[model samples]
Structures are given as structure tokens and as C-alpha cells.
Target chain A: MIVTEKQQLKMLSSAEMQLLHEGSCSLLSRVGVKVTHAGIAALLLASGAQCKGDRIMLPQDMVKNALAQSARIIQFEAPDPAYSFTVNGPENQVKFGTGGQALYVVQRTSNGWVRKSAGTDDLKQIIVLCNQLKQVDFITRPVECDLPDEQKDVAKAAVFRRYCSKPINLANLVKLARLAEVLEIIGNRAHLSFIISLVSSPLVMDSSAGDKFVAIVQKDIPVAISSCPQGGSTAPFSEVGELLQLNAELLFGFVLANVVRPGAKVLYRGIPITANLYSDASPRWCQPDSIRRVALAAQLCRFYNLPCCGTAGVSDQAVPSAQGISEKVLSWVYEAACGGQYINSALGMLEQVMSVSYYQYVIDDIALGIVKEKFSKAQSLAISQLALSAALEVLGCFGIEPDEKMEAELSARIRHIENGLEPYNETYIEDQLAVIEKAVNKSSSTVFMKAARKGLREGYLYKGARLDASLDLAAVAERLESSEGLGT
Target chain B: MNKDELLEKLEHSVVMGHLDADDEGYDGSMEGTPGTLELLEQALEAGIEPQKLIESFRVAMEKVGNLFASEEYNLADMLASAECVGEAMEIIESKLQVGNSSNKGKFLIATVEGDLHDIGKNIVATMLKGAGYQVKDLGINVPAQAIMQEIREFKPDFVGLSALLTSTMIEMEHVVRLIKEDSFPDLKLFIGGAPTSQAFADKIGADHYCRDVMDAMNKLEQVSNVS
Candidate 1:
């Protein structure tokens, strides 16, 4: 049963794939990404990555050697082995990467923000949302940050007493690293993540030094890879060239990460889409072509058989709107289709990894479902062929010849209808709303919310890993207590 | 010295990061070199206008920002570049004040409340400020009211906001609404970072969704011209 569909589409030859892979490697080694970590350079040099001063030139052999030791796949287990990014939970298995969502606060009164002091209740709510989300397979975590903002200036040293007790970005880095360290600390916990940047785009040796908090975890969270690319203003005005050059640096980063961790779960976050045609106003993300190129980038990583990350669900919009959807949907499909193991970026994320929308989590979760759905296997072999045979025997293929029967059977045997991100394409969104005779005369969602709130208050049921001894939890508690007064 | 020669000198100064008393050589450590007034004057003397000289400096600074944004360079290098750029700009500022005024426009940008990751916001701001725009950088965790108050006080033509976390992005909707309600309705609202898009901008009624700094400036200039 030959469907003969897309047969002549000329699938990329293994040679072509190899070429792309080599190109990435060469780009990385020859141009090299920027380096912020001294440890990374030492490790790369130790592992035979040709280093000239600060910049490292890693040959393809190094990349292949490092990748050979990479863990092919991993499964995230719940409640305990929190270190793995996996798909081995009780119900949902969709793991989430860090989402770069835009637009954090909604305004309250004339000049006020509707902020709920991020606390236990808020943490619990996030957990609940993660659990309830059908799209989320496993939680991407060390989910901790955002303390309440106080109007009165609190003492800098009294950070622990004045504001809601929680770690902010760089502050949270150490706490999250500890969380990572404890969670099934796999790969190289001793080495720092390899960081490489572009020569042209290079600031200097050891230029960017953030994310060092993860250093305490002993797991080399490889970073400092130059997204050094010239879209229009800086480099050639070609998307493909931009991708190749960027991928080259990123691939070098991969080698660096691998050199340090030796096939560790390196995050291959792609940063493409520079300014368009000499003008900064026409951002490449706003263009459809840019989205497709990013998608191709996912496949590019796959061609190298390396774990991939970055640039999906990210949009060029200032807020959640029409332009956001088109960009995200296009790029997300590329990510899902290209088999990216880990990726993030919110539907309403904007301005190049700066912000994300609040509702985007829920909305993007649904969008994530579309990506997760691609991994879903639909097999008709599970359905009794005999049962279908009887129904087919009664009617037959209208006017099909005997030879055509085999083709039809083959088509039916393995038919894949590409449901391109139509969330709930088959069924309308619904809940178990009907009342039964045994049910009570009334029902209340608020009551359920109340019970959940109580459990959160007790602290026995749920409490996320706390960090930052420098902050106060009192204000957060008070704010959580009066959250109902906050959200409209 | 003319514009080309001045640009070359300024480029060297920016790269080298200092100047001698007679403008002979770099004065500080190899990496710790900071920009100075002499460099700007030399750049101006080369006939490169103050604006172009600053643009050259910005070009150099953006490379640093790009490295930071992509995780190529670490935070220290990034902060150092910021320091270098700041010093360089002081020279640029003084030189401009001596003769002309360079204000691209009153551009207001901030990292919205309930979010604290400043790398992206800071990077965008650096590029904007580099381009000679009067960037009123409202530091991280800024409330909408604070933004409006600044917008009122500053009378900025553009309001820029950034967020880093997903849960916090929900807060941006209010910021947008506040600006609309309290500030100028016709205000050219531009936003960016990860999780923002053209569609999201339309959804939230933002004037523009910028991906990169070049895009931000280009769109800013187009949507609402700065006189």
C-alpha cells in the first residue's frame, strides 16, 4: 500500500544532514563563541579543544567525542528524583522549560499594581496550575522568586525582615542551583558550563559572569555562547547565513558544554533574528521568515543529534496580541516537529526574551499541547482489524479494484493526519457539569478554592523549597491572606 | 581632524577604553579601561559629529550587550561594559553640551513589578541610550503608577516595559491599561523580551512589539517621530 505522497519531496540526505552538523561544529570551533567561564576554557583545553588565549577552537572530533557520552534520553520522576527533565509523572508527562513571558504586572488603582505577594499560597497555586495543566508532563522547576514590593524603603541589610521572603533572579540562582544539586545530580557536577562567544561580537575574556550561582551546584551549566549574528546592520542580510553562523557558535558552545560535562544535558538555546535590512525598527521576529528559520534551527540541532533549546512560543509583540500568535505558532511547530527535547518562551513573550504575559501560561499550555500532541502515537492496530473488516466487508471501497484494496489498506494501515496545533480538534472544551441524583443541590468552585487555601495555610500538604534568608515572609503572608481583595 | 578620523579615534578609544593627558595611549588596565572626555573631543575633532561618535560607541556597547543577552559573556563583563559605556557617554554628553544637543526622544523604559530579571531590560536600555535617545531608565520592579508618574513628569513620547517571568507577565496587562487610562492614549507603547510578540502587542493594545534594539529604535522612530 504505497500512498506515494511526498515521496519526491526529497528528504534531506544523511550526507546533507552531516554537512549541516559539520558546519555547526566548524562555525563553533573556527569562530568560537565568547567565554565568560575560566573553568570552561580549562576543561575544553583539557579535552583537546584548541584554545588560543580566551577563545577556544573546538574541532568536530571533540563535538562527536563529547556527544558520544551524552545521555540519549531521560525521564523526570516526581516527588523525589527532582533533578531530571523527564516524562515519568503519575498523570501528565509534559515537562516545561523556563518560559520567557512578557508583561508581568497588571495595574490596580490609578497608580498601583495588582500584586499578590508571592508566597506559599502563590507557590501552591503555581503547583496546582502545573498539576492541572494537561499539557505539562513534568514541571520545569526550582520555581522560586518574586518577593512583595514595599513602598517604604527597607534597610538593605534587613532584606530578610522587610519584604516577602523569596529569592529574586540572581539571588534565586544559588537556591535553584542547590535544588538542582540535590535533584539526581547527573553528569558533571564539578565542572562549570562551557561558555564561548563570537570574536567580532566578543566583549572580552570573562565578559559576562552571571549564572555563577549554579556553580555551587557543581554541575557545569554551560553558558556564555555568543548569539553573535548580524542580520542586517551587522552581518549579511541572509537568514540562512545568520542561522549557520549562529548555529556554528552555538554548536561550539555545545562542544564546550560537552567538554565540561561530557554529554551532559546541555541547553542548546538558539538566538537568531537580528535587525532587518539595516533598520532596527523592523525586528526579524516580526517577520514570518524569521520564525521559519528558527524552526529550521531545531531540525539543525537534531541533525547533529544534540539536545536543543530556545526560541519558540517567543513572539516579537509588545503584549499578547495577533502578531504574537502567528510568530509563536509558526516557531512552535518547528520546535515540535524537529524533536526539541527542551524548549521555552511564552506565547506573549516580547522584545527578545524580556517579558511574557500572565494568562500566557494557561494559553501557552494549550499551545504546548499542540506540540506535545505530535509525540502522541495513534495506532489503529490497537483497534481490532477484524471489527473494521466486517464493517468494510459490508460496504467495500465503493468502486475500488482488487489491487487498489491493498493501497487503501496501506493508507488505512498507517495514516497520519497532521493536526497542526488545533487544540481539542476533536472535542469541544468541557467539564463534568451534569448533576446526578446523588449529588448535592448546590456546588461551589469557591469552596474548593477555600479548601485548597486551607491546605496551603497548614503547610503540611504543600510548600515549595524556600530560599533567601535575606527576605521576610510576613508581608507575603499578609498579601496572600487578602489576595481575594486584589485580583478582579 | 574630520568625521572619519574622529570616528576612527573614537572607535579606538572605545575599544581601548581610555586616553592619555595628551591623548597618546590607554591609561588603565587592559580590560578595566574606562572612556574619558578626551576621547570624545578627539572624536569630535575628527569631524565625526557627536551623534555619530556616540553611535560608534553604541555599536561597540551593543556587541557587549549581545554577548550578555546570548549568555556568551557573563554578567561581570556585561556590567563592566555598562561602566565603560557610561563613562564614554559622559564624554559624549559633555562634548555635545559644548556645541549641540542630542536627544533622540524621551524614551521611558522599565522592568515591570513582580519581576526582577534585569539582564534583558538592561540590555535593551543600553542599546536605546547608546542611540542618543533620552532613556528614562526606571529600574527593575517598577509599578505602573511609577511609570505613569515618570511619563507625566518626563513627558516621554514612548513608554517601554519589560518582564522576565511567566507568572509576572500577567502583571503587564495592568501596566498597559494604566498607561492608557492615566497617561497618553495615543502614546506609542512598545514592549519586548521573551514571551512578547506582535500578536501579543495587538492583544494588549501595545503600539509595537520589538525583538531587538535596532528593531526597537527603528519602530520607535517610525510609529512616533521624535521632534
Candidate 2:
């Protein structure tokens, strides 16, 4: 619990937290999210939500009520506490958590489809960066891969096997079911909060997607509910209005996830951005105001007595530029403020969360360090009076009017700063960068890669674990046709 | 070419990157004629060069990049765009050869073995080309010795190496050091990928890091000025 001055200014109060919660709920119920999966819609209809065809709309009060009931602090420590992190509650400081950092990150990726490249490291950098930052909650897609590249989507999903303590928000559906099937791959050791996705098309869940959704239920997987919508795209353009649409859609996803995997956990997820013209190619969620607003919106998930997952930190810059810094910070800060339980994307991600950069990842870690210093809460004084006295004497008494003595103290303090003093140290960035290298080189890769490879070799998690090693040929052919035949 | 058409082809080329399409281009193929350079020149001669052509290629491509914001285009589009840009670059490249080459310095680019993704490598190449450097791309999944061999033969001012995988990013470091330890002691090596960092660069002793195109340009300019 290291607190800093900047953190003190940014801390949210209980009442403020509740207002945010209510506002988010009001938005969720009034606007309502689309339910893409029909089966999910049925589940919500069976619940208390209002049914409109496939769409199950939630009421404003219902959203507010749900927000109030949702769990605020999720003690995320595993039964083995050693590799655990407490999914922090609001008021307890934190940054944001991202879904993942993929191999094929982009400066701009909006459409659901992206030409998959085998083993893009840009995504990996995001995972490491998010992992390096204290504010970020999850580290995902920690590796590269081979083949037609789309299965690499699963690689983003696959890294979860290595990070049980930090539950991963993998691409929902089949991957979720596969994760459940391979629970032993992770040895039931890690806590995985599965992402059960719903439609942005109101409230209908896809039948096939539902089958996969139900697989999580069958496995009794802990699921998080999300109905992400982009204005004029997956959702209407208005922020609150869009939230309402998603609320209904998400509620359906939640009910389906829980009906199958009863007691499966849920975390509300959303995007606070505008859309580009006719194409769904890009979503503008990085505006500072939008990020802040989304932070407030994520509190509605808390209304459900569940943890919240709010995304931020995707930049359009392929490298570490002012734009990258701005998008990354807005995203991270919003998630932290929203009191999200799982945060990712503090590193190695760019564009609309499409590409990754190793160097940029290093730069992101540097930014995270700077931001952490900016937001860390100041702890109570536990040091001795002697230390306090010496610390104070170094730069005190120079507050208002700088006299000769004050000038002398300031000069000495400046020298100390130049020489790497406490509070204001020398290029901690260099140290930070060094540590990043070590983390990427010495630590993160060697141990986990071996595990991931071994995990898949020994057999990976799949939706219908009827276990078909014989299907290798079909998979290969399917891969070849998608890659070569499509004429990309 | 109109903005839309230019963007479409440029996006295609970037997605379809080529490292060894070597030609001392006395031709106009790099102008993206959808075929080889000989055909590309014919396309360019139909009147493709303009400040608008250059700047708009970047702008339209970026605007096409708008798909990234609300989750429209996705990572696949990005890869496609990157490859497409690579193709368009080929076309632009031949034209560059025809003009007073921007190549203030010569750079060599490659990917380490078992690393097939070329997104980062293409970016560096394009940026270097944009900044007026004569870049020789070695393509994806290259071996360390190949780089050393390339250096021995070509004697480039800077060597840019990329590895898309963390497992392979490690190999980049080893090769960077190997270039110094075994051969090309004077080679200015730059390493990038998702896993390698500035700290990694310093620890492994890579002379410089091209954090981005602009940074690489500035770094190259500075390096040349010093020499």
C-alpha cells in the first residue's frame, strides 16, 4: 500500500463510488445492450429482465440495484496465495486490467476480423507491460505462435493456463469451453473468471456460441458477463443509451453463464467510444473524457455483486509517441478508477488493441512506472523520527518564502535528486527498462513457454473434449484453406 | 492514383511484405503496378507521383485504419494493411531509385530464425525508406549467420533485426551480440520485437534502437552526422 501525493488527489470516496454505480446502472437499464445469442436471451427472459424479442432490457433501477449488490472487493488470492493478487475493490487504488496483448496488435484494428500473423510479439509486449505495471491486473497472450494465425487467437486464450491467479478474459465461447476442458492443464490451481459474451444486437445469444457458453456452465466455470457495444456499430452512439443496450445483452449473457455454470462469477464489461463512419473498422474509446466516463460506467458491474472488467490502454501509435502515451494512460487510469477487478493492456498493445511492439512495450512499462509513482497512495509514516527529521531538514522550511537557508536546502535537495535520491531519483526509467529486459528475456518467456508448449503437447483444452487427436489432418487442411484459398 | 485506390493497394502491399525482391531498379516496378517493377513503372508513368500521392497514401491508409477504433477492421486487417503497404512501398521504392534517393545511409533488415512474422520489420523498412535510407530487407525467419554473411558482403551502416516471437526475440539478442563477437564488429545493430526492449538493447550492446520510424530517422540522421 504505497501511496503518493498524486494518488491522494485521485482517490474516490464511497459516495462518489455509489453515484458512479447508480449512473452506470441507469445507463445499463435504460439503454440496454443487444443480446446476440438467442439462448442467452431466453435465459434472461427466464430471469427478471424485460423481454423484447431476443433483447432483454434491464430497467434503470434494476441496474442501480444490481450495481449496489455486486461485489466490490474480490480477494483474488489463490488457495496457494503465493502467485495471487487481490482483485481490488473501489477506493483501494488500482490501474486497469486488459483482456490481453496479442501477437497481431495494430495501430488501428476495429473490424472483428484481422489478418492473423503467426507469433506477433507486439501483443506479447502488452502482456508483459501490463504484468510489469502494478495498476494492471492480468497478463495475457504471453507468446507467439505458428500457422494460419487465427488459432493464434487461441494463443491469447491459451496463456491463461499459465496465469490462474490472474484470471484471463479469453475470447469467449469455444476458447472458454476449451479452457474448462483443460482445467487440469492449469491443474485447477489458478482461478479463471471466464468471459461469457452476449450480443450487442440487443439480447440474443448465438446457438453455437450458446453451446460453448453452456460448456462453461457444464464445467461449472466461473464466468464474467460482458456485452460490449460501439456507438453506431455494435451499439447506439449515445454512451448511456448504449450502456442500457449492453446491460440487457450482458444480463442475458450473465444468466446463460450462470444457468449452466451456476454460481459462475460475472464482471460487467463495456467500451466508451464513438465509431468511425459506415465501417466498424475503428472505435474511438481512447478520448480522455470517454475513458473517464467509462470508468463511471463500469461501476454498474459492481451493482451485480460482481467484479468489473473495463478495458483501456490501446493506442493507435505503433510505437511510443505522445499519442500512444495519451491513449494508454487514459485507458489505464479509467479502469483503475472504475475499480475494475481484472485489468490488462498496460503494455504491448496498439491501435484499437490490434498490434504490439516490444520496444513500445518497454516504453509502456516506463510509462506505467511513471504513472504508478503518480497514483500510488502515501502510506503512514513508519520511519523513525531521526529519518523523518533528516528527510524534512533536507527540503522543508522553503515552502512560501525562500530565504538564504531555504535556498541552501533546495540546492542540496536538487543535488540529491540529481544523484538518485528518494522520491526524486535519477533515471529510474533506465532501471525500469533494464528490469523490463530481464523480465522479457530471463523470466517471463523461459518458464511459461515451456509450460504452454508442454501443456498443448500433453493435450490442450478444447470445447468438446471428446478428444480427437485424429482430427489433426482436418485442422491442418482447414488452416491451409483459410490461409491460401482466401486470397488475402 | 485516387486516395481510395492508393490506400487499397498500399494497404495490400504492407500486408504482403517482401524482403528479397532485389532489383537495382532502373525500372518503375516499385510503383505498385500489381505485378512486377516493369509493370509498376507503367502504372506510375500514367501519373502517380505527387506530394498528395505520398502524404495521402499515409493519410488514407491511416483513415482506413479507422477500423481499429470501434473494433471494426481487427488485427487481420492490420496485417493485411501492413502487407499492402509493403507492396505499395515496392512501387514507391522504384520511383525513389529513379529520383535522388532519400537514402542518407544504408540499412539492412532481417528477422531471426523460426520467426516468420514481418509486421515490425516492414514498419522499420518503410520508415527507413521514408527517412531516405537505402534498406535491404532480408525477409522473415532468417538465420543469424545469414545476417553476418550479409554484413560481410554489403557492409551496411545499420542493421535492423526483428523477431515476432518472444522465443525468437531472444535469438535476435544472441545474433546482435554474435555480430559483434564473431563478425561485423562495427555494425550498428538495432533489435525490435514484442519482447526486446531498450534495456535489452543496452544489456546486449545494440548500438541503437529504432523505437519508431520517426525515432529511427532521427537516430540515423544523428549517426550519419557523427560519422
**Fraction of true contacts reproduced, model 2?**
0.00
Over A185-258, each residue of candidate 1 has an lDDT whose tens digit, in order, gives 32222212222232232212322222232242235333333353434322222333445555655655555455
Which numbered prediction scores highest in lDDT against the true structure?
Answer: 2
Q: Each candidate's interface RMSD, rounded to one decimal?
A: 22.1, 18.2
lDDT of 2 by residue, A48-104 (tens): 667554345665544444444444454443323554665443444443445442445
DockQ comparisons of all candidates to the true complex: 0.05, 0.02
Model 2 TM-score (B-chain only): 0.58
Please give, for residues B1-227, the per-residue lDDT of candidate 1 as tens digits: 65676566656554443433322222224333324446565556656666676677777666655654574543323333443455566566675574323356668888888564444565557556555566778876688789878988888878888874554566777899888877485568888865566776888888888876557766876765643
Candidate 2 chain A: worst 10 consecutive residues by lDDT? A462-471
CAPRI-style quality class for the chain A–B interface of candidate 1: incorrect
Q: Give the TM-score of candidate 1.
A: 0.46
Native A-B interface contacts kept, per candidate: 0.06, 0.00
lDDT of 2 at A417: 16
